[model samples]
Target: MPGQPSAYHPGPRPTTPRRHDVIILGSGIAGSTLGAILAKQGVSVLLLDGGVHPRFAVGESTTHYTLKLFRLLARRYGVPELEPLTSYVGYRDQIAPTSGTKRHFGFIRHEEGQEPDPAEFLQFSPPSKGLQTSHLFRQDSDAYLLHTAIRHGCDVRQGIPVENVELEEDYVAVIDKNGDRYEGRYLVDASGFRSPVADHLALRKPPKDLKHHSRSMFTHMVGVRPTDECLRVGPEDAPPIPWVEGTMHHLFERGWFWSIPFNNTPDSRNPLISVGLTLDERLYPKPDDNNPEAEFREFAARFPAVERLFKEARTVRPWVSAGRIQYASSQTVGHRWCLMSHAGGFIDPLYSRGLANTAELINSLVWRILDALAEDDFDEERFRYVEELQQGLIRYNDELVNCSFISFTDHALWNAVYRIWCAAEVPINLRFDRFTERFLESGDDRVLREMEKTAYPGLPVPGSHGYKALFDEMVRLCEAVDRGERAAADAGKDLMTTVQNSPVVLEHLGIRDPNRRFVYPKPEDLRRMAHWLRHEGPRELSYLTTGVGVHGRPLPSALDEELAVPH
Candidate 1:
């Protein structure tokens, strides 16, 4: 049944034009999930895809934000089927068996013929089990979602290419390769990179504005060795979450390797592991031969540790390579039509933000569309906020990913840069969790809007100045490293000095004393910090954590031992 669009009963092609409340291009998770949500609301939906189910696709990682959004959408929209996707254990029984539990995000810097320095390795674990995420097998996950859409009364057609889109005043018309016409109040393009809607409307923007520029080569393979076993790190020295238990990132100068296991347990159906190499295009250009497999081998050999991990693995599918993967759209919304997240814009996948971004975009758009339909207003103005949100998110992503590439030049710099990433990510994750909980409890769209105001587009609420300052400094230091203007040792020392001097960075890293720098906190410390932040007043917590007052001056801190107690 793999690749089969389940519950689909194909009959004779439609002889007349078909109309629905909404028409979605591309049957991937984004389109199908939106379709299912709308269909459940008694809105007629049609989803068309150029390919069939169980298709090969990447972007198979999930995060805390993605899970929280899934839960929120399912609960708010009355779609219980999506609730299971929020947890690893629930997904195992309710979704598919092809996913792997992602307990931690691990990274190690490797050099040619030299073993990675254990001291330089980093592994980040979520403080709580509920926050842990999973690595998806997109083929299975997407098909399951598509089937769910069908079950929810969405009209889905596969292997059908959309040839033309005509936007009228009130509705959009879609013509397929078969000359069949479909019309709907709104047209949604989730068709991804080569978006026809984007191309036709001249929405595609040159990626020159983006800070990050990179190319990728990737494939799914079998017989890949577990990182723990390959590295031979002793159990005593191993991280709380084993490196093999989650996504492993092997870093080197100018590039990085991602190893995401699909088979972590004996029950996994697919033994294939997803592996990919992403290189900063400015530093490493594409190989002349253009054989991804051959190029991949050559690249892997540069890191002996990475090469050993993949030495015996055989590809389950053809290796795929792409030129600079960054893209952006000049506009995402027009009369009677709009583009989904991927279609609107996309940056690098280094942080696995794609799924989370898609979820956030869908959540915002679906509500707006529903409201617009109720009011009988489809003006382009109704969904303009979504465009702004999408564009801002992509810009934020560009900044973060672009800065991260500088880490590869040296392990010390990588460590410094990574702390900045963690500082930014921690608050964002917590704020998103809080927003989801608050919105679900109140069922208030205003809560969503208020939270949106505090966000830096693709980030969390309260937009603290401390976090912003840290991020800004990180970017400055990274650019300096990238330009070879700062020595790795000096950069590392500067990073420590920066962290020690910033109360916001200290709180983010769960350190109370600046004297003890770059220390990972124990589980208790993490839990205590999270509880304190959660209990504090929103505005007060923002200032306390970010070190910026409402007037932009450093806020006086009342933080002490008493506030650290868990409620």
Candidate 2:
């Protein structure tokens, strides 16, 4: 009965609704992963998916924070299978062998009818060479997670769309397209844009106030050449990492193009590449023809280097075109139902924050769900923090990406604003890394729980006043540029000045200096940062000193010795 859903029942279909402790719509990675954790914990779960496995899906990138969350989830929930997803080595060996290894995040800015300028680029790698990230082959990864849930005793239904969600005083019922009913103590809609829980509750609302406005069209493809091979840059002008080894962003004035290759690694069996173009709908209005392929070519043709990068590409599936991909809900939870992650809202995929946000939501929400199940309490008040966290994450991302899009108009502005993002990303990763390292060392749930009892619940660097000030100023400057009240050049100059003086700016990275185009911290840089953290770093970042490991070595002296370079 555990692995069986209504779709795969061998015997006669039950007339009575199937009952479970939790009923989740959409068996994508989010729902399946949640299902696996809950099922392993002895919570009866039913996972419903309208689609099947090995399907083409986007959002294929991962950050250090994302992978760390995977490790934490695996250890904390006792789901050892998830351990493989926490690193490139584990994923390549135990999971999808063809998944891409992401060593760095690279952005190359281009202008109309011109080759990319070597100086007008940015590359940021995790400080340690050993801490590799990944470009997910989502189809395989999603299927793997779903089956993991099944093996852990979570029932699943595939190819059955939920037609309606009925929420009552005690339980929730899901009615499928074929008139089958499923009942559970609680319902969670991890289903994307067309979330039945959101629809039933009339919670889906267009985020018109959201400053970020973008349309996206994406598909998996073969024959797309890597930028390293396509671009005519000399070794002296090359980025710190090969462009093919990570997610590449080809930025222009009004939009950006992403290239994620699954064929980057040596043992990779997959030759497919994930390709997409996202444009600010306000700047590049949708045309009447609605041809995504033609539109992609037209945009690429403007940037000479970008055109060569995708010249040989062939789409394996029809491109998915979306309009203004931002959406928010009036509420993410009700009496006995909740909208999980993307079901609640979504911004653009500029920084690959989707999965990271999903991880945060799961980490924060699951404990509450487990406790409520134990207590038999379904009060909406119990989930107030989850809603707030979701909203805060969305709000923060909206400004970050909205400013990023605005900054794309000029290289100087983009350089300054880019550092603003690093200010938040670096510290937050360190914070999570430190806590995760401590938990792994001590096997203490309290270490992970300590992360939740923070004043800023959903943010990466919630306690840093300097980060907040920098982010606030960035929003102000970008908003001023948007209003045509401030020139982009002047704003960039002002931001650079502020970044130079900002306490959140890590001195060793030289991000505050506009001349440093690539931010790759060496072992010595880590040692310097460790020293700074111990002495000069802000008091708010003191939490970063607790068991923070770098490149498989502990902080301070241990890291220094492990990474010592010969004189």
Model 1, range 171-272, lDDT digits (tens) per residue? 788899999989877889999987879988998887787888889999999999998887856665666666788888898876789999989866567688
Per-residue lDDT value at 25 in model 1: 97
Q: lDDT for every model?
A: 0.75, 0.82
TM-score of 2: 0.93
List TM-scores for all candidates, in order. Answer: 0.88, 0.93
Model 2, span 266-359: residue lDDT tens: 8888899999999989889988899999999899889888888888888999999988899888889888888999999998999899998998
> Number of the top candidate by lDDT?
2
TM-score of 1: 0.88
Residue 471, candidate 2: alpha-carbon lDDT = 86
